[model samples]
Target: MSNTPRTLFDKVWDAHVVRQIEDGPSILFIDRHFIHEVTSPVAFLGLQQRGIGVMFPDRTFATADHNTPTINQHLPVQDPFSANQLKALETNSSKYGISHWGLGNPKNGIVHVVGPENGITLPGMTIVCGDSHTSTHGAFGAIAFGIGTSEVEMVLASQCIMQPKAKKMRIAVDGKIGKGVTPKDVILYIIAKISASGATGYFVEYAGSVFENMSMEGRMTVCNMSIEMGARGGMIAPDETTFNYINGREKAPKGADWDKALAYWKTLKTDEGASFDVELKYDAADIEPMITYGTNPGMGMGISNKIPVAEALGGGQASFEKSLQYMGFQKEDSLIGKKVDYVFIGSCTNGRIEDFRAFASIVKGRKKADNVTAWIVPGSHIVEQQIKEEGILDILTEAGFQLRQPGCSACLAMNDDKIPAGKYAVSTSNRNFEGRQGPGSRTLLASPLVAAAAAVTGVVTDPRDLM
Candidate 1:
């Protein structure tokens, strides 16, 4: 490998682009593209209005997810908006000669879930999607980020995107996590410390002892929320966990090709003397079980801590006060004991099989709280199948948890799984924006452990308490 002070993002990005313009952004060649049912409609419509077919049909992939119900994914969706959106995607893909995996297809699932599971997401590639959490695919040492509809149109036509090289931020967290602390906690703590807009317009590269020891699932969980911190994307160097996860998948390279892939992946890490635009350090031991108390995601505090008072609001006091009024919360209230009407565990963020296993572990022997309604939706049908194969479904069912169909259910509430207005919900999904769960619904973002605890206790409680 060259001794230039290069990072993984630099390597992958340079390898994918054809040329760099003077005083302009690099035009990166995209190797893989993923599209969901929700965001592709407008982009595809733009393509049709201009009478242009997708330039590289082989590189573009489509899936009927995001709006497909987790329970019954059969013909005729229950939500008209969902059905129309999915149908539009199907028609667009067919006309544009692009491949699409629909509801009944074995490969169908959430766009991000299917990409990694099918082995299409690999190191040293450029990935783009219209959905913000598209950063999830960057776990494989790829340069991945979300784009606007117009940018999507640009990508579908040229298989390349005009992109500016973002400033890179290095966040290093050392030490081991305490028991019951997961990657979700690590990210929430980072966001809470840095605030939601702290990393805006920057690419975040996570390092140090904690990330080095993390599994691929853990890495994905961190990268998936890069946007939550206002980052363009987040990534970690490709390692054994990442390579192992890619190996043996349906679309992964095999035999000699696999050896070649691994060799190249091994080269995709930061050079010893590499410098970043910004650097921050964290102590993993200092992180706590965090919960959101306001509409925006950054309004978070430790579970055992009470909400921030006005004097503690810092510069965002006005916005914080507005958020409190919308959520009907008091400044001195403890997030730990807040009553919840619903508990949801799933999303591209925490909807993987490992997340389900984590939830099942905590709630298996107990029953759901009497007044709480809980829905556990898987990220993908593949995740759903894994839960069944692992017998996690039975455990959740026995504990009075309903296993909902795979989709983004209640994550953004584009379907019928919305929490009623004035009712509180604890969710594992990323984002806690105003009406993020539904129009006028209140959401408290937490980790899967916290969601599982709320599922059993009917209130926002610390997972440490449950343990």
Candidate 2:
């Protein structure tokens, strides 16, 4: 190890540092490859056409989540498109000799969810996924990024991916988090304050007191939204939280290997005097659970704040105004009392064991609102089983939440599950773009607690109040 102080990113980058070209990005050595139903099909076909195969097949893992149905995993998928895609992923992975964790497999779930659950994501590694939220894996101190279909083919054919170096930004959130606040709120607040484009062209590194203290799930939530904040990727340096989380995973190095890995992982931290291209800071206690009042992720406010006026919206004012008109919302209107058509509490962003526990805590013993339709999907099949084993399902069902099959249900309109046209849905998904949930369906992004609170009350209520 070099005596130079290294950030977690520096450690991982140096470990995977293959070769550097003069004035060009270093050739990165990818450690793990994650596959989902949506992006693997084309990449597989590309490989077939080239007569190539997955170079490091075991390093690649496949799961159908984005388009997999949250209901009836036992039965055939309800949507024809989804059914075909899931089937194709299974076939493609099988043909290529890659491990595909299909629905019903103990490890199957969202690509992002399964990677960490099974210890596939670890410190000092490079990870990539086809989904933009692939940044979620960076919480383990890995350099994780989302890739295009073509690039997926490149990685499958050769474990190395060509990439340009991204400018770096360190977003420091220091201080204690306020009650009723969460990492979800922290990211939402970051996006709101910085606006959606604040980190554009940069790889964001989350830092400071609040981030350092965040749980693995919270760190995942922070990194998950890196893309939304206009960064190519987001990362948090690994600490004891990261090490403990990876200790017992199926793919984690074991025994002597684990000891060896830990020695290396301990070095994955920012040096005290290292300089970054950009630096940002925020007070952790100031953040609160936020809700989107307009079409984009940035058009959000604390659950207590009213919708923004056009003047306060900056360059996106016209777009924000248009989205409000589309969603039938008006400026100065409060979001809490809006009638909700659906409440969705799972996504790559919040569909984890911790997120479910939090949601269940909020809704336990409460009856689901008669007027609200709710779906609670886990991030992965392992998460689903954990929920059942922990009796989380019973608590959820009694409280009027159904435990849906593991998949990216309602987060995107790719699967059969979708909010009907013009209906309002409070979702835990990351994006709030127009037609994100479905054509003309309005989405208000919030944390699982907020979504659960909305489900029981038939309106958006702050969970902090109920808790």
- Candidate 2 stretches with Cα past 4 Å from truth are 1-6
10 residues in a row with least lDDT, candidate 1: 309-318
Residue by residue across 1-467, what tens digits does model 2's lDDT show?
Answer: 57766565666676786888788877888889998888878988999899888889998889878887777778877768778888999898888888988977877888888889888898878999888899999888889999999989988998988777787789999988887777888999999988888888888889998988889998999999988888888898889989999998888999999999999888788888776889998887788889988777878899999887978766666777798898799999988778888998888899988888888888898999998989888888778888999999999878867788888878897887888888889999898888898888899999888988898899889888899
C-alpha lDDT of all candidate models, in order: 0.86, 0.86
Clashes of 1: 3
Model 2 lDDT vs. the true structure? 0.86
For model 1, the stretches where C-alpha displacement exceeds 4 angstroms are 1-3
Which ten-residue region of model 2 has the weakest summed lDDT?
A: 1-10
Cα RMSDs of all predictions?
A: 1.4, 1.6
TM-score of 2: 0.96
Clashing pairs in 2: 7-269, 7-270, 109-380
Clashes of each: 3, 3
